[model samples]
Target: MASYLAQEVQLARRHDEILSQRSVLLQQMETHLGDKKTEKTLQMLAADAAYKRNTALLNDIEAAEKRLQAGVHLQPHPNIVKIETLYWASVEESIPKWEQFLLGRAQTPVGFKKKKSSEYNISHAKVAAQR
Candidate 1:
């Protein structure tokens, strides 16, 4: 988790650098405002995209921090001792279930109560039981 947080911090720094460059480009484009409206528009659009990308990175960092906090609260001093072939192979399949569990959806043994359906009033207990 410390490594993950460090990587995210590095990524945020990179995004900040890119955002700085975008700001500079926007400023240069502002100087040419009277000439070539199309070019100025394109530059603005590019800056906007960069801003959106940075915003997304901020959101990802926030989510990662939240997950880290939740994990620490739930499992202190967690360690990975070994990984068998079967468990390693099924990691891709299990990740989504674990994500759902983290997001408050019920899981086998760990979470017994099923979440209520948001779109429809119908109870999906039968469907969940099948899983």
Candidate 2:
């Protein structure tokens, strides 16, 4: 019984480690994805898909650990977390800054254009002639 308990404890510790790693990766993905609507951000998200894969692996480990502890003889169902999709959405949100940085400038869509008027309008004589 003590050996079984020890195994359970080990499994739980392993699960905890995986969960921690998964959490950190998700956080990183969130940071990269937030407000980063740019091509580079998309690429970063694509790379981050690996994190999702890792998360799934961790989920599998967790399920196995649970089964081991419960002495269950059935296969556990797969995890249904949508980590990749969530990360992708985050990356979409991060686009604005990425785009601004990539474009090297910010654009004002509704601001007024400056009018280029002469300081004295031809010293006022030109206006008087027109009048």
Candidate 3:
């Protein structure tokens, strides 16, 4: 009976030790699982952000392409001739005056045809006053 009691005590102590070890293992597993879950969540968020950014960039590119296509399909200007006439008129008057002043002599001896009426000529004072 004495030997049996000693054996029972030893078994009880061993059972207690095993239970403590199991508790420690369970805590460690819980901590590891939590870390894994957090890591995966962060990875998923990063991927989602990247996907959204790429989608927006793609949308912008498509919009620009649409604008380019629309621009290409537009009709040509109807008053192209009138615009050219006006542009040349300004150039012919200004370019000769600029060249004459810079070279200290008139490059085109024939000169830019003067306006038919002096009233049409704009003086420096008149232009400055208008401004």
Sort every candidate by TM-score, greatest first.
3, 1, 2
Clashes (candidate 2): 11
The candidate that achieves the highest TM-score relative to the unseen native structure? 3
Cα lDDT of model 3 by residue, 18-128, tens digit: 999999999999999999999999999999999999999999999999999999899668698688889999988787568775687644445545555565655655888
- Cα lDDT of candidate 1 equals 0.78
Candidate 2 structure quality by residue, lDDT tens digits, 1-131: 99999999999999999999999999999887774667677888887998898999999999999989887665454442366667788888877646775686865323335344674666576879988
TM-score of each: 0.32, 0.28, 0.51
Give the higher-lDDT candidate: 2 or 3.
Answer: 3
- Sorted on lDDT, best first, the list reads 3, 1, 2
TM-score of 1: 0.32
Candidate 1 lDDT over 10-127, as tens digits, reads: 9999999999999999988887775678778889999999999999999999999999999887733324423454577687667776877677875653545555576334446556
RMSD of candidates 1 onward, in order = 33.1, 34.9, 8.4
Q: Where's the lowest-lDDT run of ten residues in candidate 3?
A: 106-115
What's the lDDT for residue 16 in model 1?
A: 100
State the C-alpha lDDT per candidate: 0.78, 0.77, 0.86
